[model samples]
Target: MTTTLIIGGSSGIGLATARLLVARGDEVHIAGRSAQRLDDARLALGDAGTDVATHVVDALDAAAVASLAAKRAPVGRLVLTLSGSEGAGRLAELDLAALRRAFDGKFWAHLTVLHAALPHLAENASITLLGAITARASMPGTAGLAAVNAAVEALVAPLAAELAPVRVNGVSPGYVDTPWWGMVPDADRRAFFDGVASELPTRRIATADDVAEVVALVATNPNLTGTVIEADGGARLKAA
Candidate 1:
């Protein structure tokens, strides 16, 4: 059985992906900062929870992340679904500290997990990184987010080459309906989703499952190294 480790798997895209992989019979180990949320996620996986394990560790805590990775050595598939919108705003007016926080939370966090698991990653294992379409699209209020995600996307090609048989790929989703938008009030979030859905070429905001399918594809397909699969509902095709 393939042992897969997913950071930030307590909720949202990470949890959705874990559900998919669990259903597919992978030994999925999920790590995050919230014990309760992790427990909930495992329960949410239903009877397949037998294939799931939960660890409470923040991605920002390098030592904790490293310890978890070491304990779960020989990980065959590594998926990173950690990111944030902390630094989102107009570039000129954006607080530099907030941008740094975004980087720390997203870019550095991803790297921390990657490096921590580097030694223990199985030979010919695959890595799937979850970023955002904002990395490529020229959006007005997402410059910081763009920078953070772009830094992540930037790792695909080079790492794929360096890692050789170990595949590296990225999944950049547009605006998925996930807990990432929990900060926005429910009504406002719904309205925002409706507005974005109308503007997208697909005419619908993606669900976490939608992006999870793409992540699974990237992780399992041997020929997909260094490729970035955009599951953005055509957001890049038409700016919002």
Candidate 2:
């Protein structure tokens, strides 16, 4: 009977979490920017007769995001995994306009969704935000991402206090095998992942399912809040 709203839930960590939560007997509704992708994820997940809803949402539109929450009132768990790279490049070549757009996609999206859903959060509800190791494991060519992720982590403590029984926490994952990697050519991606793998304590990049385990843990734990569980395979330990 617990309903979870997963923004950006059509793929990667979001979709994997959807599957895991459903398997554990939770009704899930996935909102994504692409309807086709959402549908494909639903078919692949085969929600096991559990309620699995999908929506086409552009997180940049605050009104729409808020309206969705109003429509789906009483969300017991809210997980947001929305990610974008609008102005991703060296600071010297940065485009201010694109950077603003990127903020809307990531940081602003988090605020808007939570603001709209606050009224409907169930008792003892949990809110999980997907952060990145870039928040601390600063790598070159990731300045924008690092700033944005750090901003997200900055919200955990304050929001946790304000939200109270509705626990709010975050998870920062390292490189994972997800569609985000599909953007690279196979050979390059393999090489990159192999290079990262050798340095990783886990010796393997995380799968979406691997990160989902932590997301689920954060959602169900009653004693956790104002904290972030780093699921970055110890990448933060090595530094950038």
Candidate 3:
């Protein structure tokens, strides 16, 4: 059975991806910072009698992240869905400290996990990093978000080359409706989604499952390395 490790798999796109992979019969191991969330995820996955493991580890902790990867050595597939939105704002008004935290939490965290998992990666392992549409599209109030996600997308091509044989790709989604938006009240969130859907060509915001399909594609497709797939519901086109 393929052993897959997913970082930040407690909620949102990460957890959604784990569900898909678990359903596909992969031995999935998910990690997150919250023990309670991890337990909940494990139970959810286990209820279906799927093979799933949960680990509690913060993305920012280098040693713990490395240890998790080390323990899950020979991982056949690795998915990174860790990120932060604390840096979302106009450049002039952006909190520099928050921006730094965003980078540390998302960009650097991605790299740290990748570096830690490098040695343990299976010979033909696949690495899928979750980026965002803001990286390539012109989106106001998302300069910091773009910077962080752009950095991740920038690594895809070069890393695919460097990691040769081991495919490295990215999935960049636009305005996905995930727990990341829990801060917004349910009614307001719906209104926001409605507004965004009206503006988007697809007429709807993507769900975590929608993005997970793309992640699963990149994870399983043998000939799709060095590419960043966009599952933005045409938001990129609209932004363009």
The segments of candidate 3 whose C-alpha lies over 4 angstroms from its true place after superposition are: none
What tens digits encode model 2's per-residue C-alpha lDDT throughout 1-240? 888899989989999999888888787889988988988888878744246888898776777877887787788899999888575678988777888887888898988788877787887899999889988985777788888888888889899998787899999999898997677999999999999999988889999999999999998788899889999998988674
True lDDT of residue 236, candidate 1: 89
- The lDDT per prediction is 0.90, 0.86, 0.90
How much does candidate 3 score in TM-score?
Answer: 0.96
- Assess every candidate by TM-score: 0.96, 0.94, 0.96
lDDT by residue (36-75, candidate 3, tens digit) is 9888777765664247788888877878878887887889
Clashing pairs in 1: none
- Tens digit of lDDT per residue, candidate 1, span 1-240? 889999989888898999999888788999988898988887887887767899988887878877887787788999999977689889789999989999998999999888878888889899999889999998888888898999999999999999989999999999899888888999999998998898889999899999999999999887889999999999988864
**Window of ten residues with lowest summed lDDT in model 2:** 42-51
- The CA lDDT at 57 in model 3 is 86
Order of the predicted models by lDDT, top scorer first:
3, 1, 2
Model 1 worst lDDT window (10 residues) = 42-51
